[model samples]
Target: MSNKKQKMDPRVMRTRQLLRDALVELIDERGYEKITVQDITERATLNRATFYLHYSDKLDLLYQSTKEILNDLLNNLNVTFEDKVEFDFSKDADEPHDTFMHLFEQISLNSKLYKVFLTEKDIPYFFSGLKKIIIDFISNGINFTQPDDKKLTVPRELAVRYFAAAFLEVIVWWLENDMPYSPKFMATQLMRITVKGPYLEHPFGK
Candidate 1:
């Protein structure tokens, strides 16, 4: 997908946006468990019939809203990320940095939705969906180095999951801490780990 969102019908988009905004605000005020479909419809100023046309229940509404945000993240990434491409680590950091910069910026834009998704206990389903998306995206995009001269200590799948989980937890930490560092700084830190291993070299080897 392109970085720009596709044109959505104004009326349908407006209705969904109202519903999504209502859900977010209600989650903040009364918490997810306390919220009802009625509360969402009322807050959105739409009737139950209209809400039902778009969603089945409050959980459905919340789930769909979270999904829309995730889709927006993909669009915000601003590159043809789905296609497999060779990632040359020998090159300057700018290549990786640009990708992460777009990512971190998108996360910052949707920080509220992410904060709610990461922190809320009622949305394990949503969280799992989010995790799967990340894992798939990472697995698709990254071309991990493999050579005849080397053997990995762990399986590639394990390593990918580790990276995906760590990436998510880092985002959660940044959001929880109100993003103490700029996106570029965080991207730099992550890039350092990605291009080089996370620790210092032994025996002064490069």
Candidate 2:
């Protein structure tokens, strides 16, 4: 009764990768709403039956593709979190927090796909799913124990939501503007705002 997902066969994995790539290309060229299963299959050089064997519809394909990317982002963050190193925002901007930098790098690497999904494709669920992932990750990483002198004005859940929403907006803006800044710079900016700014300070006073 392990909840882990079973490993997919190599051939199956390749096929799915093809389908996912095909979908992203199609969505980029013709937007998501106009895309049909035939378009994906044709682009993938795959048959309708083969596509159906893996995904029920284009939406399913989109969800699975996005989920895979988000899972990778979460995994990268988790690795840095596991290191148990405290993030020092005062350090040189060239040396941002590892977890944030890694997450931003993942987004930058998949910038094209994210651009299509977040802005061009008209997928509301993408944002919703992304928010949920961010919230879950932050919630798990938060330390519930605080010193006796500090008091929290806002609920822990509210703070998580606030930060997650703000982070999502920043990501959308960055992708929309073609990422004017480097991932390291963007990550550093985010860390500064979240850690050193008044938002966290006013509510979670030390």
Runs in model 1 deviating more than 4 A are 1-7, 47-49, 75-88, 141-153, 198-206
For candidate 2, the C-alpha RMSD (Å) to the true structure equals 4.7
Clashes of each: 0, 0
Of the candidates shown, which would achieve the greatest TM-score relative to the real structure? 1
Backbone clash total for model 1 is 0
- Tell me the tens digit of each residue's lDDT in model 1 across 42-105: 9999999999988999888887787778777766655644332455555654446456777788
- For each candidate, give its TM-score against the true structure: 0.78, 0.76
**Residue 190 lDDT (model 1):** 79
Q: Lowest-scoring 10 consecutive residues by lDDT in candidate 1?
A: 141-150
Model 2 residue-pair collision total: 0
RMSD of every prediction: 3.7, 4.7
Best by lDDT: 2
Pairs with steric clashes in candidate 1: none
